[model samples]
Target: MSEGLSTRILDHIVHLSPPGTLEDSADAFRKLGFTVTPGGTHADGQTANALIIFADGTYLELLHFTHAPPASTAHPWAHKPPGWIDYAFLGNAGTPSVADTINRRAAADGSGVRYAPEVRGGRTRADDGRVLEWLITAPAPSEGNGTRASARGRLPFFCGDVTPREWRVPLEPRSNAEHASKARGVAYVKLLVLPSELDAYAKELTSVLGVSPAASSASQVVWELERQPSDSQPYQAPTLVLNAAEEYEEEIYVRERGAGIYELGVAVEDAGKAGVAYTPYGRVVWQAIGSR
Candidate 1:
Protein backbone atom coordinates (compact mmCIF):
# COMPACT_ATOMS: atom_id res chain seq x y z
CA MET A 1 0.00 0.00 0.00
CA SER A 2 0.93 3.67 -0.04
CA GLU A 3 2.98 5.21 2.76
CA GLY A 4 1.31 6.56 5.91
CA LEU A 5 -2.10 8.23 5.40
CA SER A 6 -1.66 8.47 1.64
CA THR A 7 -3.57 5.26 1.26
CA ARG A 8 -6.66 6.96 2.62
CA ILE A 9 -6.64 9.90 0.28
CA LEU A 10 -9.75 10.18 -1.86
CA ASP A 11 -9.09 10.04 -5.58
CA HIS A 12 -12.47 10.31 -7.28
CA ILE A 13 -16.04 9.18 -7.02
CA VAL A 14 -17.99 7.79 -9.97
CA HIS A 15 -21.47 8.88 -10.96
CA LEU A 16 -23.06 6.57 -13.47
CA SER A 17 -26.10 7.09 -15.69
CA PRO A 18 -28.26 4.97 -17.94
CA PRO A 19 -26.77 3.78 -21.21
CA GLY A 20 -26.31 6.26 -24.10
CA THR A 21 -26.95 9.24 -21.83
CA LEU A 22 -23.37 10.52 -21.58
CA GLU A 23 -24.11 13.90 -23.15
CA ASP A 24 -27.41 14.22 -21.33
CA SER A 25 -25.61 13.56 -18.06
CA ALA A 26 -22.95 16.16 -18.86
CA ASP A 27 -25.66 18.65 -19.80
CA ALA A 28 -27.42 17.99 -16.51
CA PHE A 29 -24.21 18.65 -14.54
CA ARG A 30 -23.54 21.79 -16.58
CA LYS A 31 -27.04 23.02 -15.72
CA LEU A 32 -26.12 22.40 -12.07
CA GLY A 33 -23.22 24.86 -12.61
CA PHE A 34 -20.24 22.52 -12.87
CA THR A 35 -17.78 22.80 -15.74
CA VAL A 36 -18.06 19.44 -17.41
CA THR A 37 -14.98 18.26 -19.34
CA PRO A 38 -15.68 15.72 -22.03
CA GLY A 39 -13.91 12.43 -21.32
CA GLY A 40 -13.09 9.69 -23.79
CA THR A 41 -14.06 6.05 -24.26
CA HIS A 42 -12.63 3.30 -22.07
CA ALA A 43 -10.19 0.79 -23.54
CA ASP A 44 -13.02 -1.71 -23.78
CA GLY A 45 -14.93 0.89 -25.84
CA GLN A 46 -18.08 0.10 -23.89
CA THR A 47 -17.90 3.12 -21.54
CA ALA A 48 -17.38 6.85 -21.95
CA ASN A 49 -17.29 9.69 -19.42
CA ALA A 50 -17.17 13.38 -18.61
CA LEU A 51 -15.35 14.92 -15.65
CA ILE A 52 -15.83 17.73 -13.16
CA ILE A 53 -12.28 18.44 -12.04
CA PHE A 54 -11.60 20.34 -8.85
CA ALA A 55 -8.44 22.34 -8.15
CA ASP A 56 -7.64 19.86 -5.43
CA GLY A 57 -6.90 17.26 -8.12
CA THR A 58 -9.93 15.22 -7.26
CA TYR A 59 -12.90 14.81 -9.60
CA LEU A 60 -16.34 13.42 -10.22
CA GLU A 61 -16.47 11.01 -13.15
CA LEU A 62 -19.82 10.90 -14.89
CA LEU A 63 -19.91 7.66 -16.84
CA HIS A 64 -22.26 5.50 -18.92
CA PHE A 65 -21.98 2.49 -21.13
CA THR A 66 -22.34 2.78 -24.91
CA HIS A 67 -24.83 -0.06 -25.01
CA ALA A 68 -27.85 -0.50 -22.75
CA PRO A 69 -27.48 -4.25 -22.65
CA PRO A 70 -23.68 -3.97 -22.47
CA ALA A 71 -22.24 -6.47 -24.95
CA SER A 72 -20.56 -8.32 -22.11
CA THR A 73 -22.44 -9.69 -19.11
CA ALA A 74 -19.23 -9.60 -17.08
CA HIS A 75 -19.06 -5.84 -17.42
CA PRO A 76 -18.90 -4.23 -13.97
CA TRP A 77 -21.45 -1.58 -14.84
CA ALA A 78 -23.70 -3.93 -16.74
CA HIS A 79 -26.21 -4.45 -13.91
CA LYS A 80 -25.49 -1.36 -11.83
CA PRO A 81 -28.18 1.28 -11.84
CA PRO A 82 -27.52 4.93 -12.43
CA GLY A 83 -26.23 6.66 -9.26
CA TRP A 84 -23.17 6.79 -6.96
CA ILE A 85 -22.01 3.29 -7.82
CA ASP A 86 -18.36 3.36 -6.65
CA TYR A 87 -15.39 5.41 -5.47
CA ALA A 88 -11.60 4.99 -5.72
CA PHE A 89 -8.49 5.79 -3.71
CA LEU A 90 -5.28 7.15 -5.25
CA GLY A 91 -2.91 4.21 -5.64
CA ASN A 92 0.85 4.35 -5.24
CA ALA A 93 3.37 3.55 -7.96
CA GLY A 94 5.79 1.88 -5.55
CA THR A 95 6.92 -1.40 -4.07
CA PRO A 96 4.03 -3.44 -2.60
CA SER A 97 1.07 -2.24 -4.57
CA VAL A 98 -2.12 -1.08 -2.88
CA ALA A 99 -3.66 -4.49 -3.44
CA ASP A 100 -0.75 -6.38 -1.90
CA THR A 101 -0.49 -4.14 1.14
CA ILE A 102 -4.18 -4.12 1.86
CA ASN A 103 -4.48 -7.86 1.39
CA ARG A 104 -1.58 -8.44 3.75
CA ARG A 105 -3.12 -6.21 6.39
CA ALA A 106 -6.51 -7.88 6.01
CA ALA A 107 -4.98 -11.30 6.32
CA ALA A 108 -3.19 -10.27 9.48
CA ASP A 109 -6.32 -8.86 11.06
CA GLY A 110 -8.80 -11.26 9.56
CA SER A 111 -10.82 -8.35 8.14
CA GLY A 112 -11.00 -10.27 4.87
CA VAL A 113 -10.68 -7.22 2.62
CA ARG A 114 -8.73 -8.84 -0.21
CA TYR A 115 -8.13 -6.93 -3.42
CA ALA A 116 -7.77 -8.40 -6.90
CA PRO A 117 -4.56 -8.03 -8.90
CA GLU A 118 -4.02 -4.68 -10.55
CA VAL A 119 -5.47 -4.57 -14.05
CA ARG A 120 -4.51 -2.19 -16.83
CA GLY A 121 -7.33 0.20 -17.78
CA GLY A 122 -7.34 3.38 -19.80
CA ARG A 123 -9.39 5.61 -22.02
CA THR A 124 -8.88 7.71 -25.10
CA ARG A 125 -9.59 11.38 -24.37
CA ALA A 126 -12.47 12.57 -26.50
CA ASP A 127 -11.17 16.15 -26.28
CA ASP A 128 -7.58 15.62 -27.53
CA GLY A 129 -7.41 12.02 -28.74
CA ARG A 130 -4.84 11.04 -26.11
CA VAL A 131 -4.77 7.64 -24.46
CA LEU A 132 -4.53 7.68 -20.63
CA GLU A 133 -3.80 4.51 -18.75
CA TRP A 134 -3.97 3.43 -15.10
CA LEU A 135 -3.72 0.31 -12.96
CA ILE A 136 -6.88 -0.58 -11.09
CA THR A 137 -6.82 -2.71 -7.96
CA ALA A 138 -10.36 -3.61 -7.03
CA PRO A 139 -11.97 -5.87 -4.46
CA ALA A 140 -11.76 -9.59 -5.02
CA PRO A 141 -14.79 -11.83 -4.76
CA SER A 142 -15.28 -13.69 -1.47
CA GLU A 143 -13.15 -16.76 -0.99
CA GLY A 144 -14.30 -20.00 0.62
CA ASN A 145 -16.13 -18.62 3.66
CA GLY A 146 -14.62 -15.11 3.57
CA THR A 147 -16.84 -12.05 3.56
CA ARG A 148 -14.77 -10.05 1.09
CA ALA A 149 -17.92 -9.64 -1.01
CA SER A 150 -19.40 -7.40 1.68
CA ALA A 151 -16.78 -4.77 0.93
CA ARG A 152 -17.76 -4.30 -2.73
CA GLY A 153 -19.71 -1.07 -2.94
CA ARG A 154 -18.82 0.19 0.52
CA LEU A 155 -15.03 0.10 0.14
CA PRO A 156 -12.95 2.02 -2.40
CA PHE A 157 -10.81 0.49 -5.13
CA PHE A 158 -7.37 1.85 -6.12
CA CYS A 159 -6.23 3.73 -9.24
CA GLY A 160 -2.50 4.18 -10.01
CA ASP A 161 -1.58 6.10 -13.13
CA VAL A 162 0.66 4.47 -15.69
CA THR A 163 0.58 7.54 -17.89
CA PRO A 164 1.28 10.98 -16.46
CA ARG A 165 -1.40 11.87 -13.92
CA GLU A 166 -1.94 15.29 -15.48
CA TRP A 167 -2.74 13.63 -18.81
CA ARG A 168 -5.63 11.75 -17.24
CA VAL A 169 -6.79 14.72 -15.13
CA PRO A 170 -6.03 18.07 -16.71
CA LEU A 171 -6.47 21.27 -14.68
CA GLU A 172 -4.99 23.85 -17.02
CA PRO A 173 -6.73 26.82 -18.74
CA ARG A 174 -7.87 27.98 -15.25
CA SER A 175 -11.47 27.96 -16.45
CA ASN A 176 -11.46 24.18 -16.26
CA ALA A 177 -11.27 24.40 -12.46
CA GLU A 178 -13.76 27.22 -12.22
CA HIS A 179 -17.37 26.20 -11.67
CA ALA A 180 -20.19 28.69 -11.98
CA SER A 181 -21.63 27.19 -8.83
CA LYS A 182 -18.47 28.39 -7.05
CA ALA A 183 -17.90 24.88 -5.78
CA ARG A 184 -14.21 24.39 -5.03
CA GLY A 185 -13.71 20.69 -4.33
CA VAL A 186 -15.18 17.63 -2.72
CA ALA A 187 -16.01 18.27 0.95
CA TYR A 188 -17.16 14.80 1.80
CA VAL A 189 -19.01 11.77 0.48
CA LYS A 190 -21.80 10.36 2.64
CA LEU A 191 -22.69 6.69 2.69
CA LEU A 192 -25.92 5.52 4.31
CA VAL A 193 -25.86 2.09 5.88
CA LEU A 194 -28.49 -0.06 7.53
CA PRO A 195 -28.18 0.40 11.32
CA SER A 196 -27.10 -3.18 11.84
CA GLU A 197 -24.44 -3.00 9.16
CA LEU A 198 -22.76 0.16 10.35
CA ASP A 199 -20.12 -1.41 12.57
CA ALA A 200 -19.26 -4.10 10.06
CA TYR A 201 -18.84 -1.59 7.24
CA ALA A 202 -16.75 0.71 9.41
CA LYS A 203 -14.36 -2.11 10.26
CA GLU A 204 -13.97 -3.03 6.61
CA LEU A 205 -13.19 0.55 5.69
CA THR A 206 -10.60 0.70 8.47
CA SER A 207 -8.94 -2.41 7.13
CA VAL A 208 -8.86 -1.16 3.56
CA LEU A 209 -7.55 2.33 4.30
CA GLY A 210 -5.27 1.38 7.17
CA VAL A 211 -6.71 4.20 9.16
CA SER A 212 -9.08 4.55 12.05
CA PRO A 213 -12.13 6.77 12.17
CA ALA A 214 -11.38 10.43 12.84
CA ALA A 215 -14.57 10.61 14.83
CA SER A 216 -17.27 8.14 15.69
CA SER A 217 -20.57 7.79 17.44
CA ALA A 218 -23.00 4.96 17.85
CA SER A 219 -24.75 5.99 14.65
CA GLN A 220 -21.96 7.45 12.55
CA VAL A 221 -18.26 7.22 11.63
CA VAL A 222 -16.15 9.85 9.92
CA TRP A 223 -12.74 9.83 8.27
CA GLU A 224 -11.17 13.12 7.27
CA LEU A 225 -8.93 12.22 4.34
CA GLU A 226 -6.09 14.67 3.76
CA ARG A 227 -5.31 15.85 0.26
CA GLN A 228 -2.07 17.31 -1.09
CA PRO A 229 -2.28 21.06 -0.68
CA SER A 230 -2.55 23.02 -3.88
CA ASP A 231 -0.08 25.84 -4.29
CA SER A 232 -2.62 28.37 -5.58
CA GLN A 233 -5.66 27.06 -3.73
CA PRO A 234 -6.40 26.62 -0.05
CA TYR A 235 -6.12 23.12 1.37
CA GLN A 236 -9.28 21.26 2.25
CA ALA A 237 -9.29 17.74 3.64
CA PRO A 238 -12.11 15.73 2.14
CA THR A 239 -14.17 13.45 4.34
CA LEU A 240 -15.97 10.14 4.23
CA VAL A 241 -19.11 10.03 6.33
CA LEU A 242 -20.75 6.75 7.12
CA ASN A 243 -24.00 6.92 9.00
CA ALA A 244 -26.91 4.60 9.69
CA ALA A 245 -30.01 5.31 7.64
CA GLU A 246 -32.40 7.31 9.79
CA GLU A 247 -34.56 9.48 7.58
CA TYR A 248 -37.40 8.21 5.38
CA GLU A 249 -35.58 9.17 2.18
CA GLU A 250 -32.30 7.78 3.50
CA GLU A 251 -34.04 4.54 4.35
CA ILE A 252 -35.32 4.23 0.79
CA TYR A 253 -31.90 5.12 -0.60
CA VAL A 254 -30.16 2.48 1.47
CA ARG A 255 -32.80 -0.02 0.44
CA GLU A 256 -32.22 0.70 -3.22
CA ARG A 257 -28.53 1.46 -3.43
CA GLY A 258 -27.53 -0.69 -0.49
CA ALA A 259 -24.55 0.47 1.60
CA GLY A 260 -23.08 2.86 -0.94
CA ILE A 261 -22.51 6.56 -1.45
CA TYR A 262 -25.77 8.49 -1.88
CA GLU A 263 -24.79 12.07 -1.12
CA LEU A 264 -21.90 14.33 -2.20
CA GLY A 265 -20.79 17.45 -0.38
CA VAL A 266 -19.05 20.22 -2.32
CA ALA A 267 -17.13 23.09 -0.80
CA VAL A 268 -18.31 26.47 -1.98
CA GLU A 269 -17.20 30.05 -1.20
CA ASP A 270 -20.37 31.81 -0.09
CA ALA A 271 -22.83 30.76 2.53
CA GLY A 272 -25.65 31.85 0.25
CA LYS A 273 -24.47 29.25 -2.23
CA ALA A 274 -24.60 26.56 0.42
CA GLY A 275 -27.56 24.27 -0.01
CA VAL A 276 -28.72 21.07 -1.57
CA ALA A 277 -28.83 20.51 -5.33
CA TYR A 278 -30.31 17.47 -6.98
CA THR A 279 -28.83 15.91 -10.08
CA PRO A 280 -30.65 13.40 -12.22
CA TYR A 281 -29.14 10.52 -10.26
CA GLY A 282 -27.62 11.76 -6.99
CA ARG A 283 -27.85 14.50 -4.37
CA VAL A 284 -25.17 17.15 -3.75
CA VAL A 285 -24.90 19.44 -0.74
CA TRP A 286 -23.08 22.73 -1.05
CA GLN A 287 -21.13 23.69 2.08
CA ALA A 288 -19.54 27.06 2.66
CA ILE A 289 -15.87 26.89 3.61
CA GLY A 290 -16.05 30.36 5.15
CA SER A 291 -13.10 32.61 4.24
CA ARG A 292 -10.48 31.08 1.90
Candidate 2:
Protein backbone atom coordinates (compact mmCIF):
# COMPACT_ATOMS: atom_id res chain seq x y z
CA MET A 1 0.00 0.00 0.00
CA SER A 2 1.15 3.59 -0.67
CA GLU A 3 0.67 6.62 1.54
CA GLY A 4 0.18 10.06 -0.08
CA LEU A 5 2.04 12.46 -2.38
CA SER A 6 4.44 15.09 -0.96
CA THR A 7 5.21 18.02 -3.28
CA ARG A 8 6.57 21.55 -2.97
CA ILE A 9 6.05 24.71 -5.07
CA LEU A 10 4.58 24.86 -8.55
CA ASP A 11 7.51 25.39 -10.90
CA HIS A 12 6.56 24.70 -14.47
CA ILE A 13 4.42 22.56 -16.77
CA VAL A 14 5.90 20.07 -19.24
CA HIS A 15 4.72 19.15 -22.76
CA LEU A 16 5.99 15.91 -24.33
CA SER A 17 6.43 15.32 -28.05
CA PRO A 18 8.20 12.40 -29.83
CA PRO A 19 7.85 12.22 -33.61
CA GLY A 20 7.46 15.99 -33.23
CA THR A 21 10.92 17.45 -32.84
CA LEU A 22 12.22 19.90 -30.22
CA GLU A 23 13.19 22.16 -33.09
CA ASP A 24 9.55 22.33 -34.09
CA SER A 25 8.50 23.26 -30.54
CA ALA A 26 11.17 25.92 -30.38
CA ASP A 27 10.03 27.22 -33.70
CA ALA A 28 6.45 27.44 -32.52
CA PHE A 29 7.39 29.40 -29.40
CA ARG A 30 9.74 31.54 -31.43
CA LYS A 31 6.78 32.42 -33.58
CA LEU A 32 5.05 33.48 -30.36
CA GLY A 33 7.94 35.88 -29.43
CA PHE A 34 8.91 34.57 -25.97
CA THR A 35 12.58 33.85 -25.45
CA VAL A 36 12.83 30.07 -25.24
CA THR A 37 16.01 29.39 -23.27
CA PRO A 38 18.01 26.20 -23.65
CA GLY A 39 17.41 23.53 -21.00
CA GLY A 40 18.82 20.11 -20.04
CA THR A 41 18.26 16.74 -21.67
CA HIS A 42 17.36 13.42 -20.06
CA ALA A 43 20.15 10.88 -19.47
CA ASP A 44 18.47 8.12 -21.46
CA GLY A 45 19.48 9.84 -24.71
CA GLN A 46 15.80 9.79 -25.57
CA THR A 47 14.78 13.36 -24.59
CA ALA A 48 15.46 17.09 -24.70
CA ASN A 49 13.60 20.20 -23.48
CA ALA A 50 13.29 24.00 -23.74
CA LEU A 51 11.94 26.60 -21.31
CA ILE A 52 9.86 29.79 -21.45
CA ILE A 53 10.92 31.93 -18.49
CA PHE A 54 8.64 34.19 -16.48
CA ALA A 55 9.47 36.77 -13.79
CA ASP A 56 8.32 34.64 -10.82
CA GLY A 57 11.03 32.02 -11.32
CA THR A 58 8.29 29.91 -12.79
CA TYR A 59 8.49 28.78 -16.41
CA LEU A 60 6.97 26.39 -18.97
CA GLU A 61 8.94 23.53 -20.49
CA LEU A 62 8.54 21.89 -23.88
CA LEU A 63 9.91 18.34 -23.98
CA HIS A 64 10.43 15.77 -26.72
CA PHE A 65 12.21 12.43 -26.91
CA THR A 66 14.92 12.84 -29.50
CA HIS A 67 15.90 9.18 -29.47
CA ALA A 68 13.29 6.50 -28.95
CA PRO A 69 14.25 3.18 -27.39
CA PRO A 70 16.20 1.08 -29.85
CA ALA A 71 13.67 -1.74 -29.91
CA SER A 72 10.53 0.33 -29.45
CA THR A 73 8.04 -0.61 -32.16
CA ALA A 74 5.29 1.84 -31.20
CA HIS A 75 6.32 5.06 -29.54
CA PRO A 76 3.86 5.85 -26.75
CA TRP A 77 4.17 9.56 -27.53
CA ALA A 78 2.94 8.79 -31.02
CA HIS A 79 -0.46 7.81 -29.70
CA LYS A 80 -0.88 11.26 -28.23
CA PRO A 81 0.68 12.93 -31.28
CA PRO A 82 1.54 16.47 -30.06
CA GLY A 83 0.47 18.49 -27.02
CA TRP A 84 1.15 18.67 -23.32
CA ILE A 85 3.16 15.79 -21.88
CA ASP A 86 3.68 16.26 -18.11
CA TYR A 87 4.28 19.07 -15.64
CA ALA A 88 6.59 19.51 -12.57
CA PHE A 89 6.97 21.90 -9.64
CA LEU A 90 10.03 23.43 -8.01
CA GLY A 91 11.10 22.22 -4.52
CA ASN A 92 12.57 23.67 -1.36
CA ALA A 93 16.25 23.94 -0.58
CA GLY A 94 16.97 22.62 2.94
CA THR A 95 16.07 19.01 3.66
CA PRO A 96 15.43 18.56 -0.04
CA SER A 97 13.75 15.20 0.10
CA VAL A 98 10.34 15.79 -1.47
CA ALA A 99 11.12 13.21 -4.13
CA ASP A 100 11.87 10.45 -1.61
CA THR A 101 8.95 11.43 0.60
CA ILE A 102 6.53 11.42 -2.35
CA ASN A 103 7.76 8.03 -3.56
CA ARG A 104 7.42 6.62 -0.08
CA ARG A 105 3.93 8.00 0.32
CA ALA A 106 2.69 6.78 -3.07
CA ALA A 107 4.05 3.32 -2.34
CA ALA A 108 2.00 3.18 0.87
CA ASP A 109 -1.23 4.41 -0.71
CA GLY A 110 -2.16 1.56 -3.08
CA SER A 111 0.00 -0.36 -5.50
CA GLY A 112 -2.68 -1.76 -7.79
CA VAL A 113 -3.83 1.68 -8.96
CA ARG A 114 -0.64 3.60 -8.11
CA TYR A 115 2.67 3.49 -9.95
CA ALA A 116 6.02 3.15 -8.17
CA PRO A 117 8.19 6.27 -8.07
CA GLU A 118 11.81 6.21 -9.17
CA VAL A 119 14.21 9.06 -8.30
CA ARG A 120 16.43 10.76 -10.94
CA GLY A 121 19.38 13.07 -10.10
CA GLY A 122 22.96 13.75 -11.11
CA ARG A 123 25.47 16.55 -11.68
CA THR A 124 24.31 18.78 -14.52
CA ARG A 125 26.24 22.02 -15.01
CA ALA A 126 23.91 24.84 -15.90
CA ASP A 127 26.33 27.75 -15.45
CA ASP A 128 30.09 27.81 -14.92
CA GLY A 129 30.49 25.96 -11.54
CA ARG A 130 26.80 26.38 -11.04
CA VAL A 131 25.56 22.82 -10.72
CA LEU A 132 21.81 22.35 -11.00
CA GLU A 133 20.43 19.37 -9.07
CA TRP A 134 16.92 18.03 -9.59
CA LEU A 135 14.76 15.03 -8.68
CA ILE A 136 11.72 13.40 -10.31
CA THR A 137 9.36 10.47 -9.54
CA ALA A 138 9.23 8.41 -12.69
CA PRO A 139 9.14 4.86 -14.05
CA ALA A 140 12.42 3.38 -15.15
CA PRO A 141 13.20 2.35 -18.75
CA SER A 142 12.03 -1.18 -18.04
CA GLU A 143 8.96 0.08 -16.22
CA GLY A 144 7.87 2.34 -19.10
CA ASN A 145 8.24 -0.77 -21.30
CA GLY A 146 9.67 1.45 -24.05
CA THR A 147 6.40 3.40 -24.30
CA ARG A 148 6.56 7.20 -24.28
CA ALA A 149 3.34 8.99 -23.37
CA SER A 150 0.23 7.79 -21.51
CA ALA A 151 -3.01 9.35 -20.23
CA ARG A 152 -2.51 7.73 -16.81
CA GLY A 153 -1.76 11.25 -15.54
CA ARG A 154 1.94 10.70 -14.92
CA LEU A 155 3.07 11.16 -11.31
CA PRO A 156 3.86 14.66 -10.01
CA PHE A 157 7.61 15.26 -9.47
CA PHE A 158 9.34 17.87 -7.27
CA CYS A 159 12.80 19.50 -7.54
CA GLY A 160 15.12 20.77 -4.75
CA ASP A 161 18.80 21.57 -4.55
CA VAL A 162 21.49 22.16 -1.90
CA THR A 163 22.47 25.61 -3.20
CA PRO A 164 19.31 27.39 -4.19
CA ARG A 165 20.32 30.30 -6.37
CA GLU A 166 17.24 32.43 -6.93
CA TRP A 167 18.59 33.65 -10.23
CA ARG A 168 22.05 32.99 -11.59
CA VAL A 169 21.16 34.28 -15.05
CA PRO A 170 18.53 36.95 -14.97
CA LEU A 171 15.92 36.00 -17.61
CA GLU A 172 16.23 39.18 -19.65
CA PRO A 173 14.55 41.62 -17.33
CA ARG A 174 11.44 43.41 -18.70
CA SER A 175 12.46 45.99 -21.25
CA ASN A 176 10.23 48.70 -22.56
CA ALA A 177 12.94 49.64 -25.00
CA GLU A 178 12.22 46.70 -27.29
CA HIS A 179 9.12 44.99 -25.93
CA ALA A 180 7.62 45.95 -22.58
CA SER A 181 6.34 42.91 -20.71
CA LYS A 182 5.51 41.71 -17.20
CA ALA A 183 4.75 38.41 -15.54
CA ARG A 184 1.29 38.01 -14.00
CA GLY A 185 1.93 34.36 -13.10
CA VAL A 186 -0.06 31.29 -14.08
CA ALA A 187 -3.78 31.31 -13.39
CA TYR A 188 -4.69 27.63 -13.68
CA VAL A 189 -4.08 24.35 -15.48
CA LYS A 190 -7.16 23.28 -17.41
CA LEU A 191 -7.90 19.62 -18.08
CA LEU A 192 -10.80 17.80 -19.59
CA VAL A 193 -12.94 15.06 -18.00
CA LEU A 194 -15.67 13.03 -19.58
CA PRO A 195 -19.09 14.05 -18.29
CA SER A 196 -19.28 10.71 -16.44
CA GLU A 197 -15.66 10.56 -15.23
CA LEU A 198 -15.39 14.12 -13.89
CA ASP A 199 -15.86 13.10 -10.28
CA ALA A 200 -13.45 10.19 -10.46
CA TYR A 201 -10.70 12.32 -12.04
CA ALA A 202 -11.11 15.05 -9.42
CA LYS A 203 -10.80 12.48 -6.65
CA GLU A 204 -7.68 11.01 -8.20
CA LEU A 205 -5.90 14.40 -8.17
CA THR A 206 -6.89 15.07 -4.56
CA SER A 207 -5.67 11.64 -3.44
CA VAL A 208 -2.40 11.72 -5.36
CA LEU A 209 -1.53 15.35 -4.56
CA GLY A 210 -2.58 15.39 -0.90
CA VAL A 211 -4.88 18.29 -1.75
CA SER A 212 -8.08 18.65 0.18
CA PRO A 213 -11.38 18.09 -1.60
CA ALA A 214 -12.57 21.00 -3.69
CA ALA A 215 -15.13 23.40 -2.30
CA SER A 216 -17.40 23.04 -5.36
CA SER A 217 -18.22 25.00 -8.47
CA ALA A 218 -20.66 24.70 -11.37
CA SER A 219 -18.24 25.64 -14.20
CA GLN A 220 -15.09 23.98 -12.83
CA VAL A 221 -13.78 22.23 -9.73
CA VAL A 222 -10.57 23.70 -8.22
CA TRP A 223 -8.00 21.89 -6.04
CA GLU A 224 -5.77 23.97 -3.80
CA LEU A 225 -2.13 22.93 -3.15
CA GLU A 226 0.19 24.80 -0.75
CA ARG A 227 3.97 24.52 -1.00
CA GLN A 228 6.76 25.29 1.48
CA PRO A 229 9.73 26.72 -0.47
CA SER A 230 12.28 25.44 2.01
CA ASP A 231 12.36 22.65 4.54
CA SER A 232 13.09 24.86 7.58
CA GLN A 233 11.31 28.06 6.57
CA PRO A 234 7.95 29.25 5.36
CA TYR A 235 7.07 32.28 3.26
CA GLN A 236 4.73 33.41 0.48
CA ALA A 237 2.26 30.79 -0.71
CA PRO A 238 0.81 30.19 -4.18
CA THR A 239 -1.92 27.80 -5.30
CA LEU A 240 -2.39 25.53 -8.33
CA VAL A 241 -5.89 24.87 -9.63
CA LEU A 242 -6.82 21.85 -11.79
CA ASN A 243 -10.04 22.45 -13.69
CA ALA A 244 -12.19 19.84 -15.46
CA ALA A 245 -15.33 20.14 -17.51
CA GLU A 246 -17.13 18.38 -20.38
CA GLU A 247 -18.26 21.45 -22.33
CA TYR A 248 -14.93 23.13 -23.21
CA GLU A 249 -14.51 23.22 -27.00
CA GLU A 250 -10.70 23.45 -26.78
CA GLU A 251 -10.82 20.47 -24.47
CA ILE A 252 -12.75 18.55 -27.08
CA TYR A 253 -9.91 18.85 -29.61
CA VAL A 254 -7.13 18.31 -27.05
CA ARG A 255 -8.93 15.35 -25.48
CA GLU A 256 -9.35 13.76 -28.86
CA ARG A 257 -5.64 14.36 -29.41
CA GLY A 258 -4.81 13.10 -25.89
CA ALA A 259 -4.41 14.45 -22.37
CA GLY A 260 -1.79 17.20 -22.59
CA ILE A 261 -1.33 20.93 -22.11
CA TYR A 262 -3.54 22.56 -24.73
CA GLU A 263 -3.20 26.16 -23.58
CA LEU A 264 -1.54 28.23 -20.82
CA GLY A 265 -2.57 31.15 -18.57
CA VAL A 266 -0.07 34.00 -18.52
CA ALA A 267 -0.30 37.67 -17.48
CA VAL A 268 1.98 40.12 -19.18
CA GLU A 269 2.59 43.86 -18.70
CA ASP A 270 2.23 45.04 -22.29
CA ALA A 271 -0.16 42.90 -24.24
CA GLY A 272 0.60 45.23 -27.15
CA LYS A 273 4.35 44.60 -27.21
CA ALA A 274 3.69 40.96 -26.50
CA GLY A 275 1.27 40.92 -29.39
CA VAL A 276 3.72 42.62 -31.73
CA ALA A 277 6.61 40.41 -30.61
CA TYR A 278 4.61 37.22 -30.72
CA THR A 279 3.03 38.11 -34.07
CA PRO A 280 5.23 35.50 -35.71
CA TYR A 281 3.56 32.66 -33.83
CA GLY A 282 0.04 31.82 -35.05
CA ARG A 283 -1.41 34.37 -32.59
CA VAL A 284 -1.18 35.42 -28.95
CA VAL A 285 -3.52 33.74 -26.53
CA TRP A 286 -4.46 37.07 -24.97
CA GLN A 287 -7.02 38.80 -27.16
CA ALA A 288 -5.37 42.18 -26.54
CA ILE A 289 -1.95 40.97 -27.60
CA GLY A 290 -3.21 40.36 -31.07
CA SER A 291 -5.10 43.64 -31.53
CA ARG A 292 -2.72 45.93 -29.66
Strongest candidate by TM-score: 1
Off by over 4 Å in 2: 1-8, 17-20, 68-80, 91-115, 122-131, 139-155, 162-181, 225-239, 248-251, 254-260, 271-292
- Best candidate per lDDT, number? 1
- Model 1, residue 127: what's the lDDT? 84
Judge candidate 2 against the unseen true structure and give its global Cα lDDT, from 0 to 1. 0.48
Cα misplacement distance, residue 275 of candidate 2 (Å): 10
TM-scores, all models, native as reference? 0.93, 0.65
Candidate 2's clash total is 14
Residue 38 of candidate 1: its Cα lDDT?
79
Error of 2 at 195 (Å): 2.0
In candidate 2, residue 75 scores what lDDT?
37
| lDDT tens digits, residue span 1-292, model 1 | 4455367778899999999998999999999999998789999988899999998788999999888763557766577778888998888554467888888878887786788888889999998899998998888876556542445567888888888888877888778889999888888999989999898888878888787899999999998886843424564678899999998989988997678898999988777987899889889999988532
- Candidate 1 lDDT at 106 equals 84
